[model samples]
Target: MPKSPRKRALSSPHDALFQWTFSQREHAVGLLKAALPSSLAAAVRWSTLRVEKGSFVDRALRSRHSDLVLSARIGEGRVYFYVIVEQQRDVEALMVFRMGLYMMRLWEQIVRDQPGLKKLPPIMPVLIHHSDTGWTAARAFQDVVAVDGPERAALLPHVPCFELRLIDVSGGRAGDLVEQALTALGKVVLWCLSVSGDDARLEREIARTAAALDEVLQAPNGLAALEALLRYLVATHARFSVRKIGRLLEKAAGPRAQEAIVTTLDEIERRGERRGRAQGERRGRAQGRAQTLLELLTARFGAVPAEVSARILAANEAALVAWTTRVLTAPTPEDVLVEDGKRPAPARRPAARKRARRS
Candidate 1:
């Protein structure tokens, strides 16, 4: 059969972009500083910041979004501070509830990972929202709960309540972000992601961001970061065409920027080709397996029924393996197909009444 047209990539480009950009220690620290309160931010030992592995939020909720968890020493090395980066494209009304759940999960993980820990780390949840519409939902978990007047006061002590630090990037003001972000790379990334929806603003700010990144680009990891950013822009924004971006790069940082852009685009194309090849190989293997099972069934039990044949062909790799294994010892085709240790129940018909004899 002719292969169906390749579907668009299953993964969200925004998720990939967010993870790649903020995974760096400097960028993560910059984001934390910008989002956290001045007093709280000052207490964090920025140099001791480290990204934690695994996610606390449910996998279903994180399907097309990205989050970061980091731990840093605070209180002059006496305590640990936890920061959760909840990056979302839209405002969520149940964000506080989700954050609360994530916090509990994080604490559980901490206890599991550190057997002798004396205390749980203090957690600070930050919501990084970037949507066309500004965030208008309640920022606190208490606000989400149903309580009125005196009842609310009564329930306050019993309820788990906390607020998330909010960073709204909906305005798409590159200058303000640049001033707010701590590092040069952070500024550029924040500007790019913030202005992704606005072509005019992105074009206006690209030159300034490029100039700022020039010094950083000279560093060892600068070129890599630049490539990542360019790839992110191309992947996340529909307005960012290669030609347009290439021209912008050339204008901003001249030949070096152009070279970086070409390199990044080439790498992206290579990855896509590799993924396509791998997918084709898997499909070919699956088809071969299906065909082998059908041949076995036909040889062992004579002509396979259309329904059975269809089921065998539709079966995934695991099911095919199970059927293939059963074909050798099963007494009949139905026995081979039906699940192990279970038989299909016999059909029953309704009985006719004999009331006419009485009449």
Candidate 2:
């Protein structure tokens, strides 16, 4: 069954690009075929593969997960494949353990949705790490456990286990991964992933994927996709802004592609300006709320301690509003600022104070 698209927020530029590119059936197929073991990729019916909208990521950990789930039929059984684009900059030591937790969530959802399902479907975990330094963490669940050589045989049965199929987006081998891709857009996507955050490599890769980039511009909604790609590159690549990308596109892509490239760059710049202004407005609103909250606290109580003032200033708009709401009812700064499951710092104010009685 095709799942309806879920409303989920993307955490970063790389995540936005990852989901956008792979959500397409063609691009998804290309990655599965190119990166998976030949026998494993061949056993499944490619036509059965479809994106599953319900993400299994934990809400609090959404920023780190950047997950996409796809389901396909393998003969009489249904199989799922989970993709996680590791968004953090450094290699995570606990990643395999985290994947184990995610798998449990996926299996729980499958059972709930199906009700009387007798068997659990297997999930093939794919981890795409784009950290420039490359992945150094353990790849298999068993490898993460502390069981030593002497105890390996004794405790092996009880250990939770699964392995990750890594699509590493660093080192020169990523170019080889791109070469195995079947779709032009997939090739461009993989290349972009490979070169993100490296100024020199990104410039060099643009020249390499120029043909694929041009091919992308010819697809339906091609201009929009290209604009997204350009925006991603500009945002990640240290040296290239939209202007620099446009100038490079002019020289490298030549006359035929120049006009469209220029238009794409113009759109990117316009959106960027609008986004900047909107972000500025958000900052202004947060600052205003913080100031208002500080003043109210001062009037109701006394001078807010330096630490409390800093906390108010650093808070988001929502936090400020919540604190302000509590100011009317709550007794002290500690009570007003208390968050769920969290206690505020010890109050630094005088232990007792006289309250002015209303006439």
Alpha-carbon deviation at 183 in model 1, angstroms: 2.6
lDDT of 2 by residue, 173-222 (tens): 55225355567877777767666677777667567767777777777767
lDDT (Cα atoms) of all candidates against the true structure: 0.69, 0.77
Stretches of candidate 1 off by over 4 Å are 1-10, 76-90, 115-119, 173-181, 195-208, 212-216, 238-253, 316-322, 334-359
Tally clashes: model 1.
Answer: 0
Best candidate, TM-score-wise? Answer: 1
- The best candidate in terms of lDDT: 2
Q: What is the lDDT of residue 22 in candidate 1?
A: 68
TM-score of 2: 0.74
Backbone clash count, each prediction separately: 0, 0
**Candidate 1, pairs of clashing residues:** none
Candidate 1, position 155, lDDT: 89
